[model samples]
Target: MGDRVYLNVLASRFRAQLSYRTSFVLDFVAQMLGQGGELVAILVLFGRTEELGGFAAHEVLIMYGIAGVAFGIADLVIGQLDDLPRLIRTGQLDVMLLRPLSPLAQIATGDIQLRRVGRVATGLAVLVTVLSTSDIAWSFPKLLLAFTAPLVGAVIFGSVWVVACSVCFWIVDGRELANTVTYGSNMFTSYPITVYPSWLRRLLAFVIPGAFVAYYPALALLDRPDPLGAPAFLGWCAPLAALAAAGVAGLVWRFAIRHYQGTGS
Candidate 1:
């Protein structure tokens, strides 16, 4: 019953947004630029060499292409969904909490940036092109994992956003730190992780949960022998890692909220 009400609210808001054509065009162009930069980086790197970290130019192309699209899809659908912390700090959260619907549900469907759809379309085109040319041996399990990879990436990335927002409860201005983690992680994950130094790779593994986002699944899809020797089954850990990250974010959010209420920040 509650979900329906929130859905109605979101649907109404989405329609209202569509009524503004100028806002939509500007947003779409901006999303294109962001995704375009990512593609351009990969192209420039491949132009200098045939492969990086044992990944062929084509393979890395596929990786970035798919990763870009997957990331865009998540962003288009729920990208701005991470702004809850700013909303809370600005007292916008109070309005949300007072509603009959669950705050999370309300936030999830609160806004849809239709302009980002261009990124989504361009990304899908690249992913399909790479997959068609590549010699990846497709199977049911592999295909399932391919489809699931982007979703896992979104959840993992989104959790970082939530964790950042949660901190606003205590330090209303702590969002800068969150942006560092979220944006830094996004830029790093756009490439093959193996290309990085050992220390950096390890940092991503423990601190950011990025290894599971692209590296592990790419290993499975590409059928590349794991140079790190991670177990073959480790490739499937993306969803689990995403869930764990979200759980931790949930805890942090609760803690932050408590501090917010107590400190009145």
Candidate 2:
């Protein structure tokens, strides 16, 4: 029953996005351009220098593809609704909450954006290109892990989005900071984390676990050494780390809702 309701909501969103054909096409083009520019910048940087922090040009490209696909899919689906706070402020959340199904699920399925499909295709193209050029081994287990790596990355990025949105309940102005986390982290994660300073690397690794989400896992997939000597367990723990982050965000979201002091709309 719950799954059926979610499907209905998703169908409605798909139809609505289809209603704005021109806008959706333009949005898709803009996103592809922006993403393409990001990759071009990385390529130009690598052209000047063979490698950054022990990762070769193509290796770094793979990392970019990993982060891009992961984040693009996430934001296109569950993460883009970071606007929940504004909805709650204007009493918009009341309608969602009053629905028979879960409000959170409703919000998640409310917008089935097809523009993101273009980004996903571009991301996968880059991913396949890099993989084809790289010298990574292709054992069944390694192949399985490599394919699933993006899933963990997507969850991690989405969790960050959720946490950022939840902060809006306490401080409406904090949404900008949340954007910094979502967009900044997305950009930062696309490269080798080792390029960053020591303190920054440690912060992202332990504090936010962003380092593990892509960097560490990519290192493992590429059969490279752990520059920071991150624990062997860290690579396997990527999905768990994402789950932990989402769990914390969910707890905070619940608290915010319980104590929701509306903007009195």
Candidate 3:
């Protein structure tokens, strides 16, 4: 697959989406409002107590910001892959298979949810708000981290999306389970991971590894020692975690393709 072809295809889709400006605006606003519900829940929780799970409101907001941007960008770029089951059921998978270009690249460009820019915008707002109000001293390294963390997070979350969608090859309606994992992790990561029960914590850290996506990276950013028993340097492991997630997702995706017997003509 030529990079230029992928870029052109993505660009064309983006232009097409722009043609429906009203629909685009409504979709964007709806997405933003959906994300707002999470912010409200956090506010209500903090209304009753000064802190939840040993994190101040601002600290939690920072973590939330990181999680938001990471999740948003990942979803923006690769979330279309989640539509695999639907395409397969509708026999559109055969069209993609007949294409000369990479089917994954085609999917990447085909169903770009421009509405997700709302989530990314909200996330940037959160990050800026927290940065202005929070007491954490900003250093050059810290600034670099703040900039790069979201990209690292995008890789991690996008990789998970890939693996989740890969399962569609085996299960016809795999979306619900995948959403449970992805959305559940998004909701769960908006606060300190330490707040969850031991089993849940272990699951996020070891199985899905959502904990490392935002929590550990935030810990490193804020210079906070682990409230949990783990060593401090683990905070710096987000990029490596992302790489691992991508590696696993790539293996799963390839395995799935090999097994994929496309829907009949």
Output the number of the TM-score-best candidate: 3
Query: Which is the better candidate, 1 or 2, if ranked by TM-score?
Result: 2
Summarize candidate 3's per-residue lDDT along 1-265 as a digit string, tens digits. Answer: 4888888877888898889999999999988878777888998999999998998988898888888988889889988887888899998987887878767777877879889989888887898899788887888888888888888888888888888888788898999888877777778878898899999999887788788877888888888988887888888888889889999988998788778888865
| Per-residue accuracy of model 1 over 104-177 as CA lDDT, tens digit each | 66666777667777776666677778878889899999889878887787788777777766665666676677
Query: For candidate 1, which ten residues in a row score worst on lDDT?
Result: 256-265
lDDT of 2 by residue, 1-265 (tens): 9998788778787888889999989988887877777799998998899988878898888888888888888878776467776676678787776678766777777756778877666677898888878998878866876787778888888877877777787787677888888888888888888899989877776677787667877777788877767666666778788889889878877887788766666
Best-to-worst order by lDDT is 3, 2, 1
Best by lDDT: 3
User: How does candidate 3 fare on TM-score?
Assistant: 0.96
Which segments of model 3 are wrong by more than 4 Å?
none
Show model 1 residue runs off by greater than 4 Å: 262-265
Q: Which model is ahead, 1 or 2, in terms of lDDT?
A: 2
Q: How far is candidate 1 from the true structure (C-alpha RMSD, Å)?
A: 2.4
**Residue 237 lDDT (model 2):** 77
**Cα deviation of 59 in candidate 1 (Å)?**
1.7
lDDT of 2 at 67: 82
Worst 10 residues of 3 by lDDT: 101-110
